[model samples]
Target: MEKPLLVTDFLDRARRYYGDREAIVATTGDRYTYDEFGARADGFAAALADRGIEKGDRVAVLDPNTHYHLEAAYGIMQLGAVHTPLNYRLVPDDFEYILEDAGVDAIYADYEHAEKIEAVRDEVPTETFVTNDTDAVDGDWESFDELVDTDETFERPKMDENDVITINYTSGTTGDPKGVCRTHRTETLHAYIVSLHQEIRDDDVYLWTLPMFHVNGWGHIFAVTGMGATHVCTRGVDAGGIFEAIRTEDVTYLCGAPTVLNMLVDYYERHDVATTGDRDVRIATAGSAPPEAVIRAVEDDFGWYLKHVYGATETGPLITTSDARRFFEDGSDARFAVKKRQGLGYLGTEVRVVDEDGTDVPEDDATLGEVVVRGNQVMDRYWNKPEATEEAFTDRIEGYYHTGDLATVDENGMIAIRDRKKDIIISGGENISSIELEDTLYEHDAVADVAVIPAPSSEWGETPKAFVVPTSGDPDEPGTDVDELVSFTRAHLATYKAVSKVEFVESLPTTATGKVQKYELRQREWDEEDRMIGEG
Candidate 1:
């Protein structure tokens, strides 16, 4: 009994078993059951086939977290077409570059994001422009509603499990974003891992706080749908809107980056809002660990359990979860400490902290090494980039993907990230973790959001500089002085790891997924330097 593992299998199951179940709650105030949703996806697939879209055509989807995006994803994949989701936060030039790079043959964009694609429509190879906007329709663009208004059916192509199903682009921190190619088998296995780690149940209600474009919403679209969970879609991530959705939709589970959690915490404290309601919500956050203080606040003050997971786009976007429920039963400080570390690898995932020579690092919890992983869910390659693909899997140990993140493993097998290999600062021949310094600063009352980067220095080769967003103060004059903050870091961390300088800013630059772009900060600091030097 061997069967091809396809993402459309989840949709098929939902349509068969939970036909009348409420499947989607759109931000546009529309609701659809699984039956209706399946029909819409089918109609979209049929429309594409009618328009001469071949099975292998590359279809791009540009939208926020909307129902249309979900339908478009299923429809594109239904015809065995490659789905390419564009980051909506990117500029028009970035869009043009990606469309050209991916060789997008067709596009389905929302009204809000259509302008970015329309600006470069004539230059790219795309022949079809499908806009989901009902009110505004140009002569060159086709209306999404009209396209999916058909009752005709399309035949499903014979799909291979190893066929590339989606191509997700990286945030392009250093240069142009690289397309991470994922196959049906890879995503299907990743969704199974997500279900196992998150403990997804059929009664669960998932809120779309994370963008659908990011790693296929961290594979929740398939996992939750397969479990027959109701989806509550939000157009964008807003603190107040998230709270409203949880209260109104009875949301049981959600995922977001640490920045989103920080926003929610700030909104709750400022508005005097209560976190407890009729439902008990569990949140999964990644893209940099949440500050220990924030984690404590989320559990103690907000009455929500925060699970810190870790991974990147190239690694199926999920590798480990910090569910310490088995080891720490009581709600003690030790429990929170355990929950803060990214726990063991998910079931069937093999994770190791390896040195440059591919030797496993000691579990002393202090020896830093790059995190490497091998699993069924790991991506097969980078789209159209053979060199990048070769480099990703060219680890000393064959069949493992290098994650480019520096982390340490404790005796208990709990993994904690120290810093990105590039972001680690080497001052006086000592490695300083920017993440560690930033985490220490987060404990200070005056500091709100912070990013630590290596600043060029003739005295020590390089030094750690903190760019801080104060909770309340003038950007020019932060409430906490630089000397005091430096002293505070010295008090908590090693003296060598103390911040050498501080800059007060209104905000730190971030990717679309809310990850602080440390490379941008490093570029600014080392603009005049000949060689970028660091050790981690």
Candidate 2:
């Protein structure tokens, strides 16, 4: 009755009960059962132990969605070493910062990305540089295949549930990247909640469309594995490969950001492809709130169920889901509005939309406030940054994690994110939600993707500018023009909310996790301005 909740328990349970079941389908097309996966994890642990790695030592893993990523993760955790995963898309400078900040003793990088680490080998504190393919890489890297063939057994150090087991670095959009420290209990509970909401079944087939480095694939590494599901791995995300995998592997469940949804929709529209096989596919989209038009295309056009969740990296990466079945009784049309909202918080999590004074906002669906949450799944603190940790939890209110995301809660207690606190555009003495403007533009057929940001205006102090990625895939040959899009937005929304300027672009700048980088857009608009913040 008093069993400890350890992240290692997930793999242990799977190996014990679902040992014979397929655990992972490697990017190389090889399959491994849970027994084999567990054995490999043991081998990795032994290899780390042979290199004098002990409990609490930071071990960084930089790779894509591959079998070795999972093996290295659980293997590092088995020895109670802190599992520090790096964003594979990060450059050598970022890698150096994280490796130095975390004081990583060793790093296991994929052959594709190991060169980034080797580029700054002398600057980082990381000593043991191992890669999947030593021959493929330029540096003197050890072969991962040979390392995992260790014959020695590792002694697992005793770990407490509250011990810091993982440290995930933030995207550093605001400032220097701070390491978010999490305990075993936090990850274990977050995995359980994700399993409950995502409705992962043992027979379900999961596709690795999401980056495994992204919050440990948004904690699916444990939730999916613990459920005894089949993992179809991929080196990178491709719409064509995703479709082929679904039709061939019978993928029933997957997760991605709104950008991924847009890519799939664009791909599906240009080509005639079967969306799913015999399995009823469920896709969980987060990183950012999806537009209603995109959500409709995903459900009506692609015939796939979309669950919209919301949270940041420090907040378990998943604290809310929009998969409430009761709201979809009227059919797919009703589900669009419901799924468009971020919906309710997961069980045991307290989510609230609070005003600047730390008071809760009324659920009239009109008032805007910052979202705050408190749960076991939330991160404990920033690694070695106590001041940053204090500011995060005690910003607006004490003890509650301040999300910094502006939102509005409905009558049913479902929260819909309006815009980020810094991204909200104030023009001509009126507050404008950038997300609302983006959603209005997305309804136009010519608009493939769009991002709205505030530009400095002498007339109104600040006015909204639209960056549109058209369907033609050519910025010069965009299917739509400025006057047309402006009039289109004016007809759909209020005059003040309409975009003042429009620019057509081939693509939008996005983070490694696929979230659109709105700050980058803002930086360009305010490059000649005196200050970063715009005046109302």
**Candidate 2 lDDT, 1-536, residue by residue in tens:** 78788999999989999999899999888999999999999998999888889999999999999999999999999999999999876667778889999999999999998988999899998888888998899968888888888677988888999999999887664456689998999999999999999998899999998888777889999999999898899998799999999999999999876667777888999999999999788899873456577777888888888888878778997999888888776345788778877889999999999998899999999898989999999998999989988988988888899987788899999998765665566554344667778888999999999999988764454678999999999999998799999999887765667898999998999999999999888878888754443321
TM-score of each: 0.81, 0.81
Residue by residue across 248-357, what tens digits does model 1's lDDT show? 88889998766677778779889967565587889998744565677777888888887878787888989998886877865677876677677789888999999989
lDDT assessment of candidate 1: 0.83
Candidate 1 residue spans exceeding 4 A from truth: 137-139, 423-536
The lDDT, on a scale of 0 to 1, for candidate 2 is 0.85
Shift of residue 325 alpha carbon in model 1, Å:
1.9
Minimum summed lDDT over a 10-residue window in model 2 is located at 527-536
